[model samples]
Target: MEALVDHVKTLAKSCDAKTRREILDQLQSLCHSIESPDDTVQRISFLNLQLAGLRIGADLKLFNILSESSSPLTIDQISKNTKENAVLLGIHRTLEHSYTLYQEVDKDAFTANNVCKTLATIGAQAAIHHYFDAMGPGIQELPDLLKDTQYADPEDITNTGIQRAWKTDLSLFLWFQEQPEELSHFQHYLTMNRSGRPIFLDVYPVLEKTETNMDPERALFVDVRGGTSHDIQEWKPWHKDFIQPQTAKGAKFYYMRNIMYDWPDDKCRLNLKHLIDAMGPDSFILIDEMVLPNSGVHWQMAQLDMLMMAVLAARERTHEQWSKLLESAGLKINNIYTYADTLKDSIIEAVPL
Candidate 1:
């Protein structure tokens, strides 16, 4: 264990990208070797507590309290400062190992780490609010929902995990419509997810490579069901004159980012058919989503796929699944462009048959 720890220290100082990858793989192996079955079971059992604590900390402004301070603060000081009860303050202290969301500098003193600083941002806080306050209870009730007859096979978005958890027949959009204030919070959550991760524009440079000399008046971008147009602004650096242009027939590419994973296969097929109808024979539909593998799944992507199941009765697709999905809609895969080293983000380019 000491040797592994020392090796990690050495690898941290090495600037080579390949060396970094080696270090991560070695660390993962070392971690598994040291971790006992009991430890693993305990961690899994306490996961719900960890998630609840994170939401609680966000609500209590615990991160903010530590972030604004010059040094680590005692739990009492934090409680006193926030005018929160001491018992409530104890929840966050236990989450020190969850993520570097918070750090325990001493036995009972705490401070914010870089990850915790992100929670201090307005957008992240809004996301926390939407997730915990609006969506949490329903997510927690997923097991009971699965047992219920009405939601036994929640394939449709209307009769989904969210509906079962919330004990409502209303779809997610309709629920948000009734609670307009929640609508903005939910929209903010979407923005936080879209902006916090990798930018798809950078992954596909073809937009800039091809759009530079094209006619400005011709529609180069169409944001179908685009909310707030944040992505359009991000795309503008590549094509400055992109102004919600016309038909998918004339457009070189039809782009959909982080959209398909929210719905099941049927809904995805329906949406794909629309994109196929809009496309010319040569035009492509670019889907930005995680494409999972058949085996040795990465934990983050796997958890996300599971959460999609629990929350929306949806899933992240595998390459074979994506190919089949596209084929069902009369589309064929042209090429897949992956960003970073993870399966969490990829661009699936498909053309109408």
Candidate 2:
């Protein structure tokens, strides 16, 4: 095992991006191999403080301050810098003790390490904000959401997890729109996380590969907004409600990303109806989202599937599933251009049937 560890360390020093991920997966598998069932339970149950601690640390600019400091900081210095009391910042200390993301020069003193510096980045902070603040509270209600539905797959967007948690009937996006800052958090989160993901345009040549009737419809692309505020209006120009796209007919493209996956088939069909109503024969509805394979699903996507269920009573669709949903919704899929080999984020182009 020592030899194996040394080998992994050697491989890690020279491994490419793909190999690094494989090593990570292998490490996880190895971790599970050594754990007893009770250890597994304890790990899951006792780790609830991780998100809260990390997010609270980020909230107080703990990572930012630590990463920027010239040397290790005592708890007193950190508390003074953050305008927060040391007792309250103990959560941040607990996080460091568990994760070792910071260098502990002495008791109650810490300095930023590589992992801590990464967390200090704007992108990482955005991710922690979205997952912990925006989604965590509602995700805790997943058991109740499942229990109330009698363990069946969820159907309605109006009665989903977030709705139940917030005690509101508005859909997730609509509810976020009503909030002052949450909507911005979600948008910033998406912007940061989209950095390395697959892009449909990289693979699909809209003109050469479209292979559709290019008549009557003038060429125009409409990008739907997930949750937009004036802060993000500059990030995108075409800001339309996702639930009610209100697009111009005869437009060449009506593109939506990561929208369909957050909906049940029935609700997705209803939402697609809006696009179909406004689509010409030459027009296409481009759904850019993950199409999970029936087998060998990545944990990232699998966890997202759970997240959709936990949050919005939605499930990420497989290829056959996507086909079935779209065909039933009155759209004929022309082609599916999958850009990412790992996560299978793809562009499913279809025309009104």
Candidate 3:
């Protein structure tokens, strides 16, 4: 662990600015692994308390307590003015002790820090109002999940509590599909590095604009299980534009994103045969999806494999599994491009014979 930390520190100091940020992000994941159970529990408790405090502060208009004060105000003063219990109000002050807004001097006596003065100027109530508004159902689920440890399935973990809150109540996933601005925010959560450059913003455009760069005599791209929506339009405008052409002739390519993982060998073969019948022998088919590694046991990959099993009775495939799928489909895997940072995710190029 020490060696890993030292290696990350060295990489952070030696790498370029973007590489350094990426390294630091990975280091944060490592830190999460190293934290003691007790420490993790304490941090979760503190966060829940802080969230609760933020919620109550907004409701009682206690955020305005600092605004009304010329300097930092005591819990007694706030309780008396707001008509709330002094003890309960002190809990909020204690929860935010690390933040600059509220500083505890000697038991129950408080003073305004820099953040407090700023909050006062902006109206602390309004400052936290939006956060409280956005945190509705999902925020409440965290405390319960932290308390219950027996539920270990990643799918259940992904489906319940905070994940479900984001999925169902917030409609965050659907919102990203509908809104370009939201899609940008979602992209930040994925791996963005490529050979050393940010490939997402660079190489993505080439894959997207296949029609514009097409040759009239040849097929540019193919979508294998390409249905009504390719599901790539949220971040790839070229994909959205490419699929709309009236015909495959003239600088067009067949594009398939997230299509090959749904079936057993025989069914996948049938799907590919239909695609091959439609495409010219020279045309290329692009498949974007998870291509599991042949070696190494990744817990995340295993969990995702199980998700496919439970939901669709399908499984995530290794490269060998993918090879079989391609052969069965009457297509040959030309090249597999795995993005630099994301494990098991790849873009596969296949051609019909």
TM-score of each: 0.81, 0.84, 0.44
Lowest-lDDT window of 10 residues in candidate 2? Answer: 228-237
**Model with the higher lDDT, candidate 1 or 3:** 1
State each model's CA lDDT, in order. Answer: 0.71, 0.79, 0.54
Ranked by lDDT from best down, the candidates are 2, 1, 3
Q: Write the per-residue lDDT of candidate 3 for residues 1-353, one digit (tens) a residue.
A: 79977887787789776487566666667778999999789876776456557657556655556656676677788788778888777766666665455666666767666665544433344435433433334445544544564544322323434354455533333333664643443242222212233322223345544534355545444333333332434432222222233234322445655545544455456555655655654555666667888887356677667544333224678988888778766778987766533444666777864
* Model 1: ten consecutive residues of lowest lDDT: 237-246
Error of 2 at 183 (Å): 1.9
The local lDDT score (0 to 100) that residue 54 gets in candidate 2 is: 80
When sorted by TM-score, best at the front, the candidate numbers are: 2, 1, 3
Any runs in candidate 3 off by more than 4 Å, and if so which? 1-219, 222-252, 259-270, 297-316
Model 3 weakest lDDT span, ten residues long: 188-197
By lDDT, who's the top model here?
A: 2
Instruction: Compose the digit string of candidate 2's lDDT tens values, residues 230-311.
Output: 3224334365676685566766777787778877887688778888888766777888889899888889989999988877
**RMSD to the native, candidate 1?**
4.5
lDDT of 1 by residue, 256-309 (tens): 766688778888787777666666544667787787877777776887787777
Candidate 3 positional error at 79, Å: 15
- Residue-level error in angstroms, candidate 1, position 29: 5.7
